[model samples]
Target: MARILIVDDAKFMRMTLTNILTKANHVVVGEGENGKEAIRLFRELDPDIVTMDITMPEMSGLDAVKEIRNEFSDAKIIMCSAMGQQKMVVEAIEAGAKDFIVKPFDENRVIDAINRVLG
Candidate 1:
């Protein structure tokens, strides 16, 4: 099972993802509320993957992706975006995210993304 870090502004989102990941037998290493925390958690936790929310207070997920990729070229990240945030999702991928899952998250889709990225 892959170790994961979840970063989202919404507590409910984080809990949802945690439930999904845990039920899939993945370990959640940490949770963060924004991009800045995402970066710091990545450094400290060194999880197998990260799920990052596209928009947050301190920094955008796009920026976090860029920063993390800059520091750790192989860091695996997945962007989480709400419906109609397609442009931001694309930008996140360009910034170095491996893949993305749209919200509100679908269980199969989320698992598929994690498996795909891990592979």
Candidate 2:
């Protein structure tokens, strides 16, 4: 099981991801509502993986990914984006995200992404 940090602006999204990840036997070590919180929690929790939303208040997940990667080059991050956000998803990958999941998430895809990144 991997330690995970989930970051999203929507409370429901966070809860949903927590359920899926926990059901898959991954420990949700922390949660954040924005990129700023994501960065802070990452440093504090040092989780094995992070699921980050691209559009968020305070800071963008792409920026958070860059910041986290700067500090921890090997940090494993997976971006969560809405459909039609291909540009942002590409940017996220360039910024250091290991993978991405499109929202309205599928539980199987989420689990597969986490496993692939961790694998």
Candidate 3:
């Protein structure tokens, strides 16, 4: 189990992710609605992993990835993307996300991605 931070613009997505992580026995350290809060929470929570949506207000997930990676090189980020956001996914990876899970999440994929990144 890992300390996790879930970030997404939609409350439903956040709730869904939280449920999945909690069920797997991971500690959900925090939740955030935008990249600004993502960054702020990262510093405060220091979670072992973060699941970040690629799009959000105030700041984009890509920018947040870069900012967090800049400060914490060991930060492990998993990008959450919707279909047809392949371009943003690449940018997120280039910006320092460790892995990705497509939207309309699959429990297996979500858990697998988290495990892969944590490992």
Candidate 4:
């Protein structure tokens, strides 16, 4: 099981991901509300992977992915985007996120992403 850090502005989104990950037997190391917290949590937790929301108050997930990957080149990140955020999702991938999950997440897709990234 991988240790995961979930960063999202919506509490429900974070909780949803937490449930999905936990049910899949993955340990959630931490949860954050924005990109800034994502960076800090990455430093402190050093989780196996991170699920980052694309937009937030302080910093964007794209920026966070860039920052984290700069420091930890092998940092594994998965961008989470809402429908129609395709452009941002592509940019996130370019920023070094390993994979992505669309909003109103699919359980199988989420698990598949984690497995693929962790694998």
Candidate 4 on 32-72: residue-level lDDT in tens?
Answer: 99999999999999999999999998999989999999999
Give the per-residue lDDT digits (tens) of candidate 3, residues 1-115: 8999999999999999999999999999999999999999999999999999999999989899999999999999999999999999998998889999998999999999999
Clashing pairs in 3: none
- lDDT against the true structure, each candidate: 0.97, 0.97, 0.95, 0.96
Per-residue lDDT over 1-119 for candidate 1, one digit per residue giving the tens place of the 0 to 100 score? 99999999999999999999999999999999999999999999999999999999989888999999999999999999999999999888888999999999999999999999999
The TM-score obtained by model 1 is 0.99
TM-score of 3: 0.98
In candidate 2, stretches whose alpha carbon ends up further than 4 angstroms from where it belongs are none
TM-score of each: 0.99, 0.99, 0.98, 0.98
3-75 per-residue lDDT for model 2 (tens digits): 9999999999999999999899999999999999999999999999999999999999999999999999999
- Candidate 4: list runs displaced more than 4 Å: none
The regions of model 3 sitting more than 4 angstroms off are: none
Those runs of model 1 whose alpha carbons end farther than 4 Å from true positions after fitting are none
Poorest lDDT segment (10 consecutive residues) of candidate 4 = 88-97
Q: Give the clash count for model 3.
A: 0
Better of 2 and 4 by lDDT: 2
